[model samples]
Target: MLSTGGVVVVLAASVVVVGSVDRGATDSGLTGAPSTTATTQTEVRRVDLAQPFAGTAAAGWQDGAAGVVVPVPTPLAGFSAEQVAGALTQVRDVLITARLDPEVLYGHDLDRLAARFSERDRADVHTNKGYRTAIAPGSTLLGVPAKVAGTMTAKAGRPGELLVDTSYAFAYAFRPPDPERVNDPLHIISVVRVRTQYGFYDDRWDATGLTALDWSSYSYSVDCAAAEAGFLAPSLGKGGKPDLDAGDAERDAFDPAAPMATESTC
Candidate 1:
């Protein structure tokens, strides 16, 4: 659980705006998605999070150094568990580096994230828009650790193009770095989209495009339930256990096909 000190708020009710792209653009992760030959065999299934979602607030997370919880990715057929896990790790690394690593935050290290994206997404990240703004100054994430939760689904959208979609809920506190007084904790619920394909040369899956689908519901409340359930930290278990809402409110708001909101505190 994030130790309570003083309230710190950086971004509130911030909406994520995805830049527009030309369908003809070859670089877009969506544009000619990758495809692979289906080995004649049983169909592969979508993978769930590493831990069960019932009762426990935090599932599928391994404790890491400095109070960080590492998320374990579930794998699917056609894609090895390693491939699925690695892709998810890439997304997390990009966000963490862009917000925490001062050098990468402003240098080319950030551009590596666009290696798999389409031309439009690549340009957007470089042009100081959409993905760029999210990682730019005044948006540096607070020291309060982050929680990543989501699933991976792989399918053929086009004739030969394979589209693997990863939906993750990243809960974090947004407190800008400052020498002055402490700020309020601004709870952020971000849903990120990562597009990838099967690499013919490498004979494996590789990330191509990434984007922030939505950012919303900047609550003042902290998510102690997730911290306790995830890492099973003894200290977090104490005090009143506020429910870690399971449903992704911000993600659902953006998905036209998503079902009605099912409230669960996280």
Candidate 2:
């Protein structure tokens, strides 16, 4: 139970979950044996995004992710964590049109090509994983190869509502930008994957036919002083809601079930 985003529930079987809690004891607290209370009761109090849940503070959160679409986005149902870091920074800036070579995603040797990724490509790891309190971390972008820093709980539902409990720092840097910075670039926080997802779904599949391929290279150090200061405030405030699993627990961003060969060897 590690909810509040940064999920870590290890069940690995009967999927389907929406998020209120069995992952931690915050906002929605209560586990086993208490489902039979009905004598004029009204205890459904799990809607506290640091209180005032009705709206306003999200300020449409810039709506920068371009109406966020993963499984659905026609009506704008969900997905916070700054719109999944702004649609993964437009999917790492459209991979700069695959111009390749950010030093091949800057060294940290997952053992030389690491059999080319697959257990969901490194079972979701994040180093230099910052974005809401990864505050400065040397202000990112220097030689990418960061690891062992945490914060990544990306749950998905509502045909994938897109959840994102960020804060990373497994950074790297090869810094070879000058090929016109790829003509019209924007590499805020960075990441470049090489190959996986069975090499883009058995070879060539797009339009959501799967193939996120997610290579094991990473980037993204966008910290214009933590975006003008609003790191979501110590994980939300006004008191009474702070234990989003409290710390360091892993997986299950919406029932991961299996994907842990000791944390993705590929």
Q: Which candidate is the best by lDDT?
A: 1
Question: How well does candidate 2 match the true structure in TM-score terms?
Answer: 0.18
Give the best candidate by TM-score.
Answer: 1
True lDDT of residue 228, candidate 1? 22
TM-score per model over all chains: 0.39, 0.18
Please give, for residues 1-266, the per-residue lDDT of candidate 1 as tens digits. 01111212211112222222222210001112122332353121111222112122222322212222235645443455575556555555544554334444344465665553444356545543223213333344444344444444444334333334434343433342331221111222222221212211123234344433322121212333323221111111112322332234433533323432232223
Which residue window of length 10 is worst by lDDT in model 2?
A: 230-239
Measured with C-alpha atoms, the lDDT of residue 88 in candidate 1 is: 50
| Per-residue lDDT of candidate 2, residues 149-248 (tens digit) | 2223344533443433322222122222222221111121221112111112212212221113222221122222232221111111111232223112
lDDT of each: 0.32, 0.24
Candidate 2 regions with alpha-carbon error over 4 angstroms:
1-139, 142-144, 148-210, 213-241, 249-266
Residue 99, model 2: Cα distance from true site in angstroms: 14
| TM-score for predicted model 1 compared with the true structure | 0.39
